[model samples]
Target chain A: MKKLLDIIVRIFRFIFFIFYYLKELVLSSLFIAYDIITPKDLMKPGIVEVPVDLKNDTAIIAFANLISMTPGSLSMDMNPEKTKIYIHAMYLHDKQEFVDKIKNELEKKIHQIFE
Target chain B: MIDWIAAFFLIAGSLFMLVAAIGVVKLSDVYMRMHAITKAASLGAILMLVAVSLLYVQWIVWIEALMVVVFVILTAPIASHMIAKAAHKTNMPKGPNYVMDELEGVDTDIPDKA
Candidate 1:
């Protein structure tokens, strides 16, 4: 009975995380479309390497995939050591802010879902 | 009310598709363009499928749309990831103003493929 409750809680958390991310994702994608559509010099595309704290392979892949799916970001490659993930961002204004989102928000949620 | 609802959805779906197409062309490079194509195209496809499913309101049609959404959600990321990796390996050029290559100096033993 305890195990069943635990499983239920995890599934609920996972679903909630998906919905939360989906809402943010859709809104941002819409905004990104505008940036692309404009004639203004609004985009600064760059490849950034973000250090990874999550050791699990599943978590790493999920994080990378989510980064790719998010507006204006694409996961390029993880180094041979898997210590850092290289990503291309349409707007490369702040590296620390993006990495913080990956570490604190995305990776934290992924850890909750998986382990 | 139903007519209005369906019309709204159809319009929304078409707008997304149009944006995706324009983005693919206007965006600078392969990876950036991939970001535009996969994200916009998949979202557009989902919205369009949902509008169609709502229109038909048939059991099989609804089920088929549900399946399509699931399939798209599952595969789009995988496709984007693989393509990015391949592009990286092939030394595909990024946009001119694009800055930084985090993978620049990292040595990798992964062999190039035929």
Candidate 2:
């Protein structure tokens, strides 16, 4: 019964993530489209290191890929130890805030689903 | 009505693709260009696939469209990462507007060009 409940919760979380990811995909695309349509140099590209607590390779790769697909962020590379990932962001105003947002929102959701 | 909706998605997808093309030409450097390609272009393609599936309304077509989307979402990021990594490792020229680089000295294999 406990296993069944766990499975049900996982399924619910997975469905929610799918909807969340779709919303992000469309929103990010529209934002980029707006940037591209205008004649402004509105980019502030920078690289930042984000630490991850993912236990396995598959989850790490998914996290990276999701970041790349999201707004203005790309996963450039990972360290040899796989503890940290390097990201190139198009618009980076606040470093610590960005890190905190990803940890709290994206990473936490991924952990709930995978871990 | 459904036909009109499908048409709208198709047109929107094509417009997004055009925007991606313009971005590739207008952006400052490779990194910025990739931001256009990986995000806008892939989303545009997915929208087009969705439009196509909507028009056909067959189970097989729906499955095929879903497969395409899955493949694209899986592969596009890895491909862009490879390019970005290679550019960084090879000391590719950065745009004039970059602010910070935290990856500097993080990798030992990057040839010391500076």
Candidate 3:
């Protein structure tokens, strides 16, 4: 049945995301402590606007939050229209590349599950 | 052997908490500090809970500890988001090293401080 296949696929994706997010969280937390432990030139901690396509409130909030727990990035605020989110990132090698990853990796997976 | 594993987790958890505490003091400004509190501290606490559950060696204790862990994982980020949002909205001071704050331009409703 198509419905059965959908449910099965969704469940697998759910498991995949849980592990993916957890792995990233633990690693990033270690990185944060490592940054503090060793004296390095601190990156300018500035906020960048991440353009978003997610409109559903729950998914949008989760998307914002998923980034926050990571080491160098924190979601500061969402725009009034939900079109963008402000993130305080420790580094920004290439903004467009970063945004593209968010869309391709995070937003797409989350959208499949919640939206 | 069980004790050894539990002790490792206990030590690990305590160390994370210690690092988090130090980070909170050493880190400047609110946004960075929030990172210390929620991420490091939460992980530390979760590890501690695991150690406690292991030390007690009881199913009920493990269940209860896991319940607490679940609650913590669910709430910590939400709490951090609230603080971050409020901090962003109210114009809290930023650290010296950070590059740019684009949010200042995006939020039109922020009243002129002068």
Candidates, DockQ: 0.62, 0.66, 0.55
Candidate 3's DockQ: 0.55
Candidate 1 lDDT by residue in tens digits, A7-86: 99998997997786567557656876787778887777777778777778877777776777666787777776777777
DockQ of 1: 0.62
Order of models, best TM-score first: 2, 3, 1
Model 3 residue A42 distance off true place after TM-score fit, in angstroms: 2.8
How high is each candidate's TM-score? 0.89, 0.94, 0.90
DockQ of 2: 0.66
Task: Pick the winner on DockQ between candidates 1 and 3.
Answer: 1
Question: What stretches of model 3 exceed 4 Å from their correct place?
Answer: B108-114
Poorly placed runs, candidate 2 (over 4 Å) = B108-114
Deviation of model 2 at B99, angstroms: 0.9
Worst 10 residues of 1 chain A by lDDT: A20-29
Q: Which residue pairs come into collision in candidate 3?
A: A44-B97, A44-B98, A44-B99, A45-B98
User: Which scores greater on lDDT, model 2 or model 3?
Assistant: 2
